[model samples]
Target: MNLRQTINSVQAHEKELALFNIDADERIDEELRSFFRTQNVRITTAQTASGCPEEIAVLAAGETVLAVVEVETLRELVDGAGAQSRRLGVTDTAYSEVLSHLKETTFTSCETADMLYASREIEDRARRNGTGTVHAGFQRCSTIVSQQAIYEDLSRTGVSVHAYGVPDVTPPELAGGQVHAVGGEIADLWFVVYDGGSEESQKSALLAEEDSAGRFYGFWTYDSAIVDSVCQYLTETYLGGNGQFPQFRA
Candidate 1:
């Protein structure tokens, strides 16, 4: 199969092999459902930050791994190439919109950074609570340029990183443009298309799917064993039982 096909296949079957969640409680209404039915793609919400409860457990595990890394390096990795904690997107227009939204929104300026920090805290806490091995994979633009930077960053924090792609996935034109802006690098990047339809089609189809299913959601669940293995590697390779990292509480 071609790249696009490969991406689609990967996305369609992501949950078949991985452990993830679909929030069945957050359903859409009928009006939205009817509107979405004519669309070609579906849009569903997934927890991407520390605030979501479903993600809290796994995020905590990620934090435990991060605590062992050097703080200055972690900060540098986050403040990549002098870019601040601003909204990022695949195109100029979208980027602009993200910036505008960030400025106008009430979110904290250090939201992303804090989220990263908290992931470590959460992970540490979870481990203490005896939560069995947790596996978490982060998804972002996975190309060569970003990959090296991301790899270096995650490596310092003791995360075992890998590159994966969704099959048959033609990243949105805007996303493609963004990747280009960063230099056609796909190294540390992993791609997961949230909505598998045209921009116009996605909004409606997503609404319809949510309404029919009585919930709004997204896909892909990774293997818990994979998460455990990666974490174990990091703990053994870098953490080495130093216990210098701060302990986390639920």
Candidate 2:
């Protein structure tokens, strides 16, 4: 079916979705065909469907596309009865004359091909690494403490310390198979990221902060004694290193 016809037929399905891509030029706004025509208005406008604002007047603009999306949700009417499904429209609005504009509505052109390639590269690497305990450095805390001591005694003397999570399960691309530090912070997987409310769920807060790495960056605080204890233990352990070959017993 033609795209326009398909767009008209979209309705949320309980177990599936209907999607269609429309060229940017086919949109309500001036499309590719009117690129040259758009220049006369650019002096007073900041919108660019082609992502090529004033560059040669989109001399060779690529085809931009937006996805028409629809979603379905189900709710249980009773304890054992089958749930009822509700159809949701993507472009629908409470006012019959209005339309919705979501980030999903943004047009993506050939510019995204590089991003797509990078994602595929990351996927290919995970497949090669397989599922196994990747001991990045096999540092048994004792080793890290020693390194910390050496760094302190020679490089830094009185600065408070922050520990780095080593052997990060999945480090950034530039890490080169060697993860020296853990990420900024770890989430409490056992606890709800937030206290749930009538308007929102705890998971909603977490999901809202979820980043490209699939991690939720939650804020937290800690007791000073707990911090001191950790510092003292590491300092003592490192300072009391056994008199062994190639060791710093200072």
Candidate 3:
């Protein structure tokens, strides 16, 4: 399937987040709702029930509670130390913490900065593991240039790196990385997929497409099967019959 089709497949499994035991403060409640609105996560309020914890937010796939977080923590996520700001890392809230709670959840109309944060997280995993294959699509060659340094560093770690984009400008010469200057449908997509090398638990991917200028729609997932599909598609479509990317030595 094409990149867009791959994304649509994941989007079909919709999920919802329900807030519980939150203090009756309209401003706080409204802020929480507004924050989730950007991520396309459905937000609701429910009375603290037997199974659900007080002052917690429950993320559910229908009846199954997939994840939960404290309402106060959720607030800290949306609003950092600065009372009026939506900056991340507020009160010790980490970026990985956000990923843990929001993995496999769809986000609509996200900014480029948001995508960059998610991409870096996956890149960092591959860097630390010092193995695996990384597949990234930057939409344009210039965009790939913007991330050249990180990809170069990843290549130095012996991680195979494949970068894709339309040749809108000259591509960077990444020493141990392969640059696929292709066009057509791939030009509209931005993605990062890591195979987790020999460790299946570390598999993760971030896939998104620009819905409009400066606005992105997509999701980040840690599911191994989902990650496999994305990496497989890129391999078959770009790497050809060999079905293998060139390995780089550390």
Candidate 4:
């Protein structure tokens, strides 16, 4: 199969697998359902059989329910990101809080966690918890998140990283042209589109710090069209990749 087809197949399998694997409770908590609904997260009730491995909730951003959120009830919440704390799978982020709030939801254990996985790649506590063997495929969290530096955050669930550290690679003075936020929202706006060679675009030799999502940050745009155009340039030119796209002498 082609790259696009393979990606789609993997995505489809993941969605089906997530739903099929969940062991839902008899009834969902009304308050918990209401809270998620308010945040635009679609929640549904599941019918789990008696011998199911673990319980989980289908969480969807759009029509696709690509994730499962296991509910957890807590008498007290403990939180930390240190080595010891992370190994225990302890987290108090927004994702975990929603799970904690639900009274009827049963938490998803590591053994049962497949779809909506915590970003922690290491399984230091696996020998004790007996969840599963430490999978080699986990992404080791990065320490420095500076521009061009990459890291996986426990708070986020997808390949996309929305969190970005301050920009140190690119200076503001080199910005080709500024894009300010519109609708009366105005401030210093800038962007750097990777042109395959460097973060600096040939059009505007200015360097915008490349963020975790592979986009240049540290700028705002008043005109949506300008930002869209810049991003489109990045996608069409860079996203295709160097190998897939054959280079030619101009």
Q: Please, what are the lDDT tens digits per residue for candidate 2 over residues 1-250?
A: 2211211222111011111222333232222212212011111113356644232111111232222221111011111222111111122333111112220111111122322232233222223333211111112233344434322322122212222233324322222222234222122111111111121211111001234564422211122232233223333343233311122211
Compare candidates 1 and 2 on TM-score and give the better one. 1
Pairwise lDDT winner, candidates 1 and 3: 3
List, in order, the clash count of every candidate structure.
34, 2, 0, 7
Per-candidate TM equals 0.20, 0.15, 0.74, 0.22
- 3 versus 4: better TM-score goes to: 3
Cα lDDT tens digits, model 1, 99-139, are: 22212111111233333443343334333333222222232
Candidate 2 weakest lDDT stretch, 10 residues: 70-79
Cα lDDT of model 4 overall?
0.26
**Model 3: runs farther than 4 Å from truth?**
19-28, 35-40, 46-58, 65-101, 104-106, 241-250
lDDT of 3 by residue, 74-188 (tens): 6766665354223221122363444354544445555777677778878999999999999998988898898898899999998999898887787678889988788766777
Q: Of the candidates shown, which would achieve the greatest lDDT relative to the real structure?
A: 3
Model 2 / residue 94 / CA error / Å: 33
> Model 4, residue 20: what's the lDDT?
25
Best by TM-score: 3
After superposition, which runs of candidate 2 have C-alpha atoms over 4 Å from their true positions? 1-221, 241-250
Model 4, stretches more than 4 Å misplaced? 1-28, 60-66, 73-250
Q: How far out, in Å, is residue 167 in model 2?
A: 13
Task: State the C-alpha lDDT per candidate.
Answer: 0.26, 0.22, 0.73, 0.26
Worst 10 residues of 3 by lDDT: 84-93
